[model samples]
Target: MGSLSRHWPRIAVTLIPLVFALLHATGALHLGVLQRLDDIIYDARLRATMPRTLDERIVIVDIDEKSLDEIGHWPWGRNRVAEMVDELFDRQQASVLGFDVVFAEADESSGLKRLRQLAQAELKDQPGFVERLNQMQASLDYDALLAKSLQKRPVVLGYYFTGETQAKGVLPAPVMRRSELQGRPIRFIGWSGYGANIEQLATQAPMAGFFNPVVDSDGVLRAIPLLSEYKGEYYEALSLAMYRLLVGLPEVAPGFPREKFFGSRSYGGLESVLLRHPKGTVAIPVDDKVSSLVPFRGAGGVSGGSYRYVSAADVIGRRLPPGSLKDKIILVGTTAQGLLDLRATPVGEAYPGVEAHANVISGLLDGKVLFRPDYAVGYDAVVLLLAGLTLAFTLPLLSATRAVLASAAVIAALVSLNVYLYSAEGLVLPLAAALVMCITAFALNMSYGYFVESRSKRELANLFGTYVPPELVDEMVKDPEAYSMKAANKELTVMFCDMRGFTKMSERMEPTQLQELLNAVFNRLTDIISSNRGTIDKYMGDCVMAFWGAPVDIPHHAPLAVKAAIEMAGAVRQINEEHRAKGIPEIGIGIGLNTGTMCVGDMGSENRRAYTVIGDAVNLGSRLEGLSKAYGVEIVASETTRKQAPDFAWQELDRVRVKGKEQAVAIYRPLAPAAGLERPLLDELKAWGAFLRAYRAQDWEQSDVLMLNLQRMNAKKYLYELYSERVASMRLLPFDPEWDGATNFETK
Candidate 1:
């Protein structure tokens, strides 16, 4: 609970994108950019996966520029079109033939109507002219000739639906009636008017279909409605008609989803269009509008090579060998630019509209049509939920590198799943929401971590950076909430290091020189203190105060403080050596260390605040520094500090009562690490220990013997000499039973 409260801000920022994504998925908000990106993704996937190889089963008889130039312009005399149809059926042996062009009006290029008018008015007196016109009418009526050629043949005529209410010519029989839908409220592409074949040709080829494609908002013709409604009748597309003719003209019916899978409620759409034949039923999947995405084979046009292109002039002029198009499904359409048959498609911007129909026909025969099922919206919601929530909760907890990798993996999984459905199951599912949500979540999470959370860290660094080592600051920033300036009681080690003989050095040197020298000396001592993870409390003129285990916790703080004091003393020694080389006055430092419970935090007046420690232990530490001069040692440590640092060898200086305290406390001076103690020092320490025991026991003779031996070992050592004089003074007095052997200091 505490951790969550601490990191709530970061987690909330990570969820911002997720909230927007959920709104988009649930239709509460619409993101047009995501839609556009989805379209691009779908187009690219379609283009990349298209089969560019030739489909020989479907062929396009292109009415290109060559055909127009060789056989005059389009809407050529119906007699010429009749002759071309005869050549394809009688000579080429095509199994099924369909026209992508509509014969909406009668062909009058034979001049038979003008001749009839002349016989009626201008040449009424010429009886022989009227009779000759009647005889040639049968041969000149081009519409009749084309109708005769189309009869009793496997032919499917093409037409188009329009949004305008003015119908022209006559529409063919609808594949399905409104009564067949059983009031399911399926939404079919609706049209109010149409341009179909004239009655004369319609009777000959009554079976026909509309070729109206569904253009997307981006003006790309990627799908075609297999069934469009006009006056309560559902008509089929040209591609669907051709496929039906090739498969024995199966009966069409509405295909509803099974109730077990989609529940009993209305799905608001048709699942598929079923083609029922004697053998089996073929199901063609449809989207909400009863449309199917055209599976483009590849780029379009004659040079595209996805479908074989035969020029109409060649077939009409008998340029190809007979039976060459045997068993091939031929579609007659124009690819000439003047015909305005080019369309924008996924694979090509200027794709032949005829090739789109051809590709649909090919896909229908192979059962590879793509569609979005009714549950696609639900699928999108589920995906977005999973992806968004996963990133929202997990990204805030992960490191930067892991978060990036996790976000990448989620995006890859979404893309792979979407592509697999498209390729293997022919399902066109929504992916943009999930992908955008993941990327946005990761970016937002990282940004918040860097900007907002890092601002908190920077503030922490600014507050305590000067008082503690940068390494300790780094540790503190990892969980900045865990640290603060609020005062709290904690067991810590405090240090007070005072420079000795600073007054004498100041008197002998220039003010600037003295300042420079002091700064140099303090800089060295501060470095030593910081290197050992000590938090410097303050510097009081000739003294520097530091501690361990505040703002950040250190379990072995006592040892660290002791270690830093020893190093500080050594630094002062080195500085004094440099002073000696330069003929400057030598200096010294006295360090005191104590470990106990103290109040540690940012403390002081509002105008001048500092992160420092205060308590009895801190005061005792200061008094220990003063006692270091009396003991003639560079470092002094309280008994509590000595007890914590067992690895260091210590010499007990005295048990003394300072000015403020009535209770006496034991103090010791650190010599060196226990492992590094020399044989002579160890022997002297042994002798000094015996002297302390004898002096405390008031055995003057024994104390004298031990002190003489200690002085002989190190005659010039001040601590041994001071203890000798103390024992002499005490020996002159009577052996008093009330004496506790604790020395007292009247002043600090």
Candidate 2:
């Protein structure tokens, strides 16, 4: 089951494309599916047009929700609509007007019929009779009045057709009728009769066409059926006929050059309609099947709004001004509830039916329409394969970061090419497919990277000794590349601090109390070290081994080490106070510091490893701690560490050779030399230093004179006894030529 589930994606890959091809080839493309494709195209194209700020020539007069409630239902009387037309042509001076609505019926109400009945003397008081007469006269079915109005100027009417058996409209003559269907009687369905105004309207304004929508499978209108054939006849759409008539071009077929059809000069399916503007005939490419792709510019039409709609109910009253219908072409239609013209579209859901026609006309005017040809499919297949294969092959070979960057690069490349084709060549490639493929490859690679790295992290962190610090586990994961189990020379200040006489203290306390007390002390000391940016190397029983400047850089390593030593001593004092309060024995701490090159890294055998500092410097630091008690101090450092930390006051102890090193080096006790008189104490130390040198040279008179004067000046002196004892011992040992001031201590 697991294997089948894993391979299910491949099975789907093989089946889906075959299904897509079958649907396309079988002529099952419907209004619903085509709409979905149109929506996808709209989503991408609209993103491209986001940056445009202004367009100058187009203007939109809104017929908003305000106008709808101001009026009642749609399809008002024709005389009032004629007034609106006069207003636009005469007052607004609009160069041309195209009607998005259709006039399938006519209005015939005139004021004279209602006026006659109300004037009779007897009927005035009879309320019921007067009401019936008003209703009768108010309903003057005037196809004649509207026809006379149409004669005043150019006007176009709109209509539509259905391919079903219940389709309406008389068959118009087919333009490209072939003799191949010879002797086969063709049946045509059409409108049996039209409330057509022939004398006044049709004679003056002769252009008319259908407005049937070519919907896709998703109920989206992506194209217009430019020409429909039935019973050896053809008819035009409403927008096409009006456009053809206004341009004064041949309506049967627009004269497009044959080369335009072969090359890039595209055209719609209808006859070549010369643009009324200076632009010559537009090439509209209708497939051999008599359908044309509607080149939709976008949702925003003239003045960035759709068509201007005047409510029919509002026009019936004098709501619109005079001269409303002067020279404009008025096509009238309905926009009432229950009329059911609303369609779901990308830009809007409640879009009026007539607005779709307006969008087409606007596209025609702006030349912003993007049409798809049958040839685009073949071109896109090659593009998708190239884009997909490139990412799939490259992703596995690169690191996670590089793979992400490459994926973005591929997406950007595909988008740039798509946009370039749109602007330069008027061709739109299938960009979404390539983007999907790039994302797929990137996702796969990153998922695999995470899976592989997760195991490595657990393995690497576990390799650290079981008792090692948990913090080291995280550092190993963040960068396993820089870490090496082998040691390397690193300059650091290593600290080895231990508690004095811990075994005696532990023996007196209970096991739980001892454990708890140790935890409390260690936790406090460790926190102090970390706060100073010192990496705790390891903990050995009650002792701590820490260092500065490893796995990360700490610039003031010497000062930090000195400060940590002081804080640990203070903590020991606090811990001893707590022990006294609890009636337990007190504990003291000793800290030693050394500065030199040390071997630092994760060190140990395969079973146990530690990130620590080790070398002669580490050994010296541990050795220095043993000498602290003899010097009557808590913190001590070798000469190298003392010199590095010049800010601290110190008392120089005698030169000492540690257990491991034969070379004798000076050591110092880290102590506050003078609380209020630093210069005085410093002067005394310098004089004592002079005296010590004299005594070493066997000049007893000068040594005795300098010590007596220092003692008299500094009465509370702490190092005075040490100097006196050193002088007494030197005199007793006598004057050997090999004598060096090397002192050895045995107590902690």
Candidate 3:
């Protein structure tokens, strides 16, 4: 509760960005940043996943520089173009021919009108000149010759529409009329002007399509309009027209999503274009703009090699093999750099504009067109709502490691699903919005946790900086609401260490020197305890109290306490050496450790609370610290501690009742880690065990003999000497069989 109360502002801050992103995705708000990001990601994905293989069905008849050098530069005379068309249809056997070039104006390059004027005016009296002009007139009319070649042929001429005011030349027969869609409220892109074929060619080849390419705001040609409106009539793109021609020129109609009968509503937005044939129907996908994404085959130009390119010069000269373009849809386009027909696309920066139309045509034929319908906005919104809110609320509750894993899992799943849809279903769904939302939500949440929530935690660390180990403080702050100062009973390992000769040593030193000495000693001892993961409870004069398994839980608190006790005893040796060199009396410390259930937490008046432990187990720890003198050892621990940490070598001290507890707890002095104990130490332990066993069995004679041998083995060992004297005194007294061999302590 405390942590939550303090850090709720950070949690709320993390959610604010998510809400704004949701609003933007759902169209309620217009922050345009996410949309731009989505556009870039979509472009990259499209480029990366393009099928780089060639499509053999469609071929490009390119008027490249090589062709230009061989057959003269572009805006070629109508007579030569007439020959090229005848060569492709007559010699190469192309099934269908479409021009990417526009022939809007009349072809007067042959200058046939000037000769006729001379025959009529200046050479009127010349009989041969007038007759020759009259005879050669039809042969000199190149436009008439080209029109004658286009007559009754499967040649689709290309033209262009503009946004300007006036419509120029003539347009082909309308594929769809405005009267058909009059009452449906269909929104079509309206164009004002157009550049169409000359009247002769338009009348001869009535089948034509506008070759106007729709470039995006970024100047990239990603989509081509399948249908556009001009002067109350609808015309098809070159790709759509060519596709219709290939499929037997089916009737094209506007398609909408299947919906239940609702009176007089716009059929939402254009979903697809339906082609109705006698045999069956084929639905070509398109977006609301009536545009379809250009499925790029590869990078650019000849390197893409999506379609076979044939030189116009070769075809015009009939230098190619027979049936080389047999039954193939041939599109006549220029790849000359000066033609300015190159366009920018997702796949390439300078992509040929004609190839962009070719890609769309091929995609429509194969049913591999990528569709991004109006409903994609709704899909993006749903993903943001589900994924964004999930991360926003849940990430703050997780640890740093867990939060990272969670974010990674979400991102991986989202990307995998998106890529799968792209590969399998041909759906160009909006991936950028969902992806950006997830990333931003996670980033914002993590930053808030670090900059905002962590500030409170750092403050908590400073508050308890000197009282506990830094690691403990860190763990406690992870869930500060659950950690309270209220008293609670927990199984903990507590330690109490008191300087044995500190009072006598301090009496001889001045107050200033004694203070310095005490500070140095406490500093060294406290470091040992903290380094071993124990929390210091308090310090009184020369005595220091510490514990483990509170503020943070250590499953093996007993072992940690025992390890700290050993290290502290070793530190005293170093302390004493320094003191002896400084001409001051050296002191020793006795440490006692007991592992059991005890009450631990902050306990005191409201103004002076201290985080400490209190219970019978704690009292026993203090009593054991005092008994270290009686055992002639520096450290003593209850049997419970020895049992929990069996990896350490322990020597039995005695079974005695302490000042507070009634149960006669057995105590032992921990020596060293059991792995490093010498064989002599093991043998001595065995002998001591035997002596204690006999002493408990009332075999005084056997016990006396064992004790004497143990005394000889360690003649200066006071613990053994004390036991020997006790055994002798016990022999003089009457023994009771009911005795449990427990010595009772009568004083504190």
Name the candidate that leads on lDDT: 1
Ten contiguous residues with the weakest lDDT in model 1 = 258-267
lDDT of 1 by residue, 228-303 (tens): 9999999999999999998988999999975533232347678899999999999998998999999999889999
Residue lDDT tens for model 3, 223-294? 888899987888999998989988899998877766433221334776778899999989887887788888
State the local distance difference test value for candidate 2. Answer: 0.60
Flag the better candidate by lDDT, 1 or 3.
1
Q: What is the C-alpha lDDT of each candidate?
A: 0.88, 0.60, 0.84
**After superposition, candidate 2 runs with Cα above 4 Å error:** 1-38, 47-72, 82-99, 105-141, 166-204, 251-280, 285-338, 441-748
1 or 2, greater by TM-score: 1
Supply the TM-score for candidate 1. 0.60
Clashes of 2: 47
For candidate 3, the TM-score is 0.59
lDDT score for residue 50 of model 2: 39
**Model 3 regions lying over 4 Å from their true place:** 1-11, 260-267, 449-748
Residue-level lDDT of model 2, residues 689-721, one tens digit each, is 787687667666687788888888775655666
